[model samples]
Structure formats: C-alpha cells, structure tokens
Target: MRPDLTEPLKLLAVRVERVLEQVLPTPELEPSRLHAAMRYSVLGGGKRLRPLLCYAGAAAVGGRTEQADRAAAALEVIHAYSLIHDDLPAMDDDDLRRGKPTCHIAFDEATAILAGDALQALAFELIANDPGHSTERSRLAAIRTLALACGSQGMAGGQAFDLGAVGRQLTEFELKRMHAHKTGALIRAAVLMGAELTGQADSHQLAQLARFGSLVGLAFQIRDDILDIEGDTEIIGKRQGADIARNKPTFPSIMGLDAAKAAAEDTRQQALSALSSFGPEAELLRDLAHYAVDRPS
Candidate 1:
C-alpha cells in the first residue's frame, strides 16, 4: 500500500526537478567537459525527496515555499555529490545508482571524483549566493546549515563511522547515532535551511521540525533496513540485502523486524505530533512521515 498522498508528492517531486535543473550551475567556459560531467551527475534522476522535505518544512512554518526551493536544490546538489563519491571504486564500488550506471561507471573514476568535488563546492556557492536572502546573516545561516549537515559533524562523519564499523557489532544507540548523523543530518538540514531561507527562525517550530527530522530520519534508515530484507534491486535501485551481505549492524539485525516496525511507527507518530499546530496543511508532512517507513524503496 502507498503511504503518501501520491498526487501531491508527485507534484512536489516535479517542482524539485525543475528547481534542480534551473538552479544548478550552467557554465560556458574553456573546459566544459568537467562542468558537463558535474551537471550530469547532479541532474541525473533520483527521488529529490530531500529538497521537497526542505520546502515542506518551510511551508509548515508559514514561510514562502519558493524561498525554500533554492535551499532544497542546493542541498540536493550536496547529496548528489555524496552519491557520486560513494559509488567510486575507492568507496562502495557501486556500479549502479538509482538503477542506472553509476558516475564511475558512466565516466572514468577520476572524472567521477572531480565531478563530486565540483558539485560539493557548487552546493555551498548556490546557498551562499541566494539573492532572496542576500545578507551576511542569511548567507552565514545557509552556509552554516549545509556545512554542519554535510561536514564531519554530519553525513561525512556518519560515513566515517560506518566505514569503521563494518563486520562489527554496534549497540542500538550507536547505530542510531551513526544514522542520525549520516542520513538524518541532511534530512534535518533540508528543513532547517528551508526555514533559514525565509529568515523564519521560530524556536519552537525549529525544535519541533528538528525532532521530526530526527525521528523520520532514523526511521528512514530503519525502513531501508526493512526494504533491504524484502525489496527488489530493480525497484529499490540499489542492491537489496547489500547491508546484510556486508554484515552491517541494521535495526533488524539488532531489534528484530517486528520490533523495528513498531519503533518506526512510534517515530512516525512523534513526527506527526511535532506538527500538531499546523492543522490540516501539515497533512503532507504527516503523510510523508508515514511514507518514510512504509516506502518500498
């Protein structure tokens, strides 16, 4: 069964696609090859869910969704860069991403690495150059949001932890810590940056969204663990059961599937509660929280 309001999420996904293509750097320069490669990797198809979450988080706080769109696009650029590097032979050695030839597969390993580096820089540049939020405070807030979420304190740190923990047992708390930093940090950043984009720093709302992001972000990984157990590679894009194959310490590996499902549901409930004041307009966010766990991919 579908866990989302398919029509609305579908529309939002398309909007994110438009934002990415429109905002990503388009250069007319002497060496267009690398630029083209960067654009290709950044623009290549994915769910674009992170940016949509950013926009939704902003809108939940009565901020302009349009303001959040740029932030969303910028966050996605960082995400795409991570994927390109993650797929390199030096890393996961993945030859498939989003069910297509991975960056290192489509281009040489060197080009893939260069494209990832360039896209990472572009993510910061786009957020820092936001014309709408053109102020030192705005620029700093935007950069700070991305930096913390993507840096050693965030996704990169999570990856470092994951690399260290392979074939080893991690406590449930340890696992959650790793995922919160690696996967949930960007998810949270998407929302926080969306709010920052509009200069709406509602302390209560930010805290609520932060809690929601944490719940759903962890739940997202839990559900991925579930899917890795049951999903197909073709539909889910990446290899199913890869986590188990690698002997990774997943929620199911520690908590059992039934308990994991219950935990995910608990997280979803908390996520919805975080937006209780938004009334009916937060239906999409609530639906997404449910979907985060229920999605097959």
Candidate 2:
C-alpha cells in the first residue's frame, strides 16, 4: 500500500504562477528590448512542471513554499530557453509549441536565439543575485545546481545525443539515458534546490528526495513516450507524431506499448517508495508521483 499523498502535487502549480510573476521583470523597465524577448519566451507559457517539482521537493522537507520560489522560477527560465532553441530551424524546425507558434516563428530566429541566450544567463543571475535567499553561499550553490542541470552534463548533453540519434536504432536504455540528461537533470536539481531553500535539509532526507526526483524524472519521459503514440495534439499541445516523424527512439518503439505503460507504472511505484521515509510529510510528493505519469501530456 502507498500513502495517499495528494496535496503536495496540488499546491505546486499554483505556487509556480506566483513565482513567475515575482521573478519575471516588468515591461516598463529599461533594457526593454531584451526584457520583451525574455518575457516573450519565459512568460509565453508551458506546463511549468520543473517549477512544481522544486516546490514539491521543498514541501516534502517542510520548507516554506515561498522559499523555493526563486529556484522554481530559475528552472522555468532554463526550460523556456531550451524550448526556444529546440524549435529553431537548425534543430527540430518545429513551428508549434504548447498550442502556439514557436518563438522563432512568432518572433525572428535571431531574436529567438538571443532571447534563449539571455534567459539562460538570467536564470543563473536570478539565483546568484537573489537577496531573499539570504546567503551568498546558498545562492552560489543554487547557481551551481542550475549550471550543471542546464550545461554539458545535463540538458545540453541530452540535446546533443538526440541530434546524433536521428534515424538510428537505439536500445531502450539508450533512450532512457538521453532523457535522463535532457529532462531528468534539471528535475533532480529542482528538488534539491527546494531542500536548499529551507536553510538545510537532513542528508538522509535529501537522499530520499533525490531518489524521488530520479524516479519521477524517468517516469516523466516514459509517459511522454507513451503519450507521443497515443495522445492527441490538442491535449499534448505539440504535434503527436513529431518523435516518430523525426525517427527518434521512443519507449513504444523499443519496448512495445504495453511494456512502456508497465515501465511507467513501475517508475511511479518506485517514486512513491522513495518518499516512504517522509511518511505523510511528503504528501505532495506522493500526489505528484501519480500525477506525473497520469497526465495526458
């Protein structure tokens, strides 16, 4: 049996909205061109899953949700930047995202690239320069967290792998490995950042949160793989067959549909187990485990 952790997942999305409003700059301010691009992309909107994960991680350890806001906002910025670049003509050449025009389509490709670059820098600056976080040391650590998640070892590396894998046969493990870096890295860091916001988290508890993050992170990709096959573009927002069209290796392609669903279930179970030590303290985390896989997109 598993704990009925429902609230943790419920609170995060709302919190994410507040965080975005707080961190994203006002349009009236100077550097208006850059700010317009920054707001255009970051505020353009998506699921905001990464930010929710950050709050969930903090809440699991009894940290205040507001304390995790900066981290969540920063992660969203990085995520938004990745999307901007991913849709460029040189990359996926995607025209639609979240049911709207891609940045490069709505704006110019050059502007889109510049906006992504600026948002990446802004994410780091948000963490390193946040006064509310209360300590330069902690802020610096947050910077490190975002850097590793977004850089060579994480999102960037994942994209590189994806680019190289086109029209190739990749094993299930290889498919998993690609997503682990591309999407999972930042997710894990989001959870850790939540703990960091609380001043300090017990090492044992932190380990458990990392485990929770890892399980959900992978599950997220597996579910995504399944959805790409079975979901509609209306709900997924992006085109449904894009992965197949690109010849990307998906769980369904390698493991079969039933196996992919089973894998997602197993990952969700493991995610729940990771929060066992938190007992009811991880209620939101528990809810998220179910929600992550169950979500249509």
After superposing candidate 2, which stretches have Cα over 4 Å from the reference? 1-11, 30-33
| Model 1, C-alpha of 141: deviation from truth (Å) | 1.4
Models, CA RMSD each: 1.9, 2.5
Q: Candidate 1: where is the Cα deviation over 4 Å?
A: 26-30, 133-136
Q: Which candidate is the best by lDDT?
A: 2
**lDDT by residue (tens digit), candidate 1, 1-297:** 565546877787788788787876565753576776777787757777788788777777667767776678888889999998877887777887888888878878888888888888888887777776445685688789889999999999998888888899999989998999988999888867776676766778778778888787887888889988989999889888888997889998999999988888888788888788776655667767877988877
Q: Evaluate residue 111 in candidate 2 and report its C-alpha lDDT on the 0 to 100 scale.
A: 84
Model 1 RMSD in angstroms? 1.9
lDDT of 1 at 20: 80
The global C-alpha lDDT for each of the candidates, from Candidate 1 onward, is 0.80, 0.82
TM-score of each: 0.93, 0.93
Tell me how candidate 2 scores on lDDT: 0.82
* Model 2 C-alpha lDDT per residue in residues 1-297, reported as the tens digit of each score: 332224545456666767777777766887676667678777746777888888877777888877777788899999999999999999999999889888888878888898899888878877777666446766666677778888988999999988988899997778888898989988888888888777678889878888888889999888888889999998888999899988889988999999999999999999998887786767767777887888867
